[model samples]
Target: MSTLAYGCMGLGGGWDNNPVTRENINQAHQVVDTALEVGINLFDHADIYTLGKAEKAFGNVLAERPELREKMIIQSKCGIRFADNEGPKRYDFSAQWVSRSVDNILERLQTEYLDIFMLHRPDPLMELDEIADTLSVLKSSGKVRHFGVSNMNQHQISYLQSALDTPIVVNQIEISLAKLDWLEEGIMTGNADGRDINFTAGSLEYCRKKGIQLQSWGSLSQGLFSGRDVSHHPQHIQQTAELVRELAYKYNVASEAIVLAWLMRHPAKIQPVIGSTHLDRIKACAQAPLVTLSREDWYNLYASSRGQEMP
Candidate 1:
């Protein structure tokens, strides 16, 4: 239950046209070192990042700094399989797959157990009872301490929880000023023009009421806040920049900090999973917990995203 979860995606040795090398590993070490210096107690990972290269890369660093292991919480996700590089993707939630995945994670992370283990994404065909049974076994064996899901909706969460004895601790999703559908309606709410489709409804409020923590992936909007044209959608880009600037000035921090703070400001007590390859950006995200935003500011940004004032 770290206040902020620092993502290790970029550090897993890819993105930004940066080749994964010894220098990259050294930079990752530096990033982790900086995160430690700033009191970032949680490190977030996924089994599929960099095609399973991320965990091994992080393992190298952890092996070197064995002493730092006690000071941090490591969480990794499983269940998504990228057998084909082009991605006719598959998901495996069977007990056997879950057990094998945990074994691989432990070996790659160079750790005995994970503080939190999550299903990377909800499998449409998954059997809740089967998945839950696997989690039970893992918990009993000390392979995973807590259980949760990523990219899941309320119904999906409920389906899994219904058959499981373990408490679903958190739901990690894409939530940002740019992606606010979960706040307005459920994830099933979609726009007619085949655009502006939302998938989760009042997800923030739901998690709050249920005592389920919310973790945000793509906290920087997939580098959208970095002033890059991720989609070439002019309006989206304009709105993101404007909101980032306004909030930055109000908070007296970097634009990225405002974005992170907005998610952190929610009542759900969100822990943003920052995916930055640069050490400096990672350090800036570590400062997010310190930025406090007023209710009005949070709503103002929300309105900007919607392009209308709240009723």
Candidate 2:
């Protein structure tokens, strides 16, 4: 898998009930072409993205150019359901739902097997034994080659892994310059201020220790540190944007590369899922691996974003 992945969240049109149009399919083709051109082979998707139209749009691209499938590592997630007659919007981990959702995801993507099938989120009502059995069946049937989880804490992942024969290979979570909880969780340890951080303690270390790939979801921070407007934003955000611009010029790479390089600098080897659909932004993001931030520069950017000196 590449250190960077092209996210398909923005591939399909809107999140409405509208069907996938030719325009959507063409856009998917362009995205795929650019990602591949820039050496991004992994593509990320979720069943609920754009109401499943995202997968449908990519499926159209694959159906027309079957050869491209061989050049990609396709992964998708499930377990999130929207509100309907069944019940209010909730996470479902029942055997029936997992099996049915996998089938639908495969059908929409027009693929034989997913490189990695992730559980979108934890279901409060999930039965460990039952869910493990369901995933075991999927693996036996060759529908899913590997399994992973998203938005799960270290305890949740360890508990789930204990019940399964296969290892949980990836843990996707929100990690970016804008979201500093993951980093602050470590720095603020043994301090009262750490109590307010939302990220689960030891989550990052657990993944690194267990050899589980840590994939970042909101890795770009919505271009907050890149080129997005920040006039109304906090002082730290505006300052971080200016620092990112300086580093981009110093390293001779795009602003996107500087922003992502901050996350890549961590020893965890995080795989950032770049969610941009624009060709220029995609290319800019692919330049991240080319520029590695030194420890001093990395700390400068971190402190600038946090708007405080490290304790």
lDDT agreement with native, every candidate: 0.79, 0.95
Q: What is the lDDT of residue 137 in candidate 1?
A: 89
Q: Looking at candidate 2, what is the lDDT of residue 252?
A: 99
Cα RMSD for predicted model 2? 0.7
Cα TM-score per model? 0.88, 0.99
Report the C-alpha lDDT of model 2 over 54-142, residue by residue, as the tens digit. 99999999999999999999999999999999899999999999999999999999999999999999999999999999999999999
lDDT of 1 by residue, 1-311 (tens): 55778887766565333445777668768878888887787888888777666777788888888887888889899999865775677988878888999999999889999989999987777877788788998999998999888998887888788887778888899887678776666423453432455665555666787888889887788767655664666674577677777778777777778888888887778888887776787777776777988888887777767666554
Q: Residue 19 deviation, candidate 2, in Å?
A: 1.0
lDDT of 1 at 52: 64
As for candidate 1, its clashing pairs are 185-201, 186-200, 186-201, 187-199, 187-200, 187-201
- Which structure among the candidates has the greatest lDDT? 2
Clashing pairs in 2: none
- Residue-level lDDT for 200 in candidate 2: 91
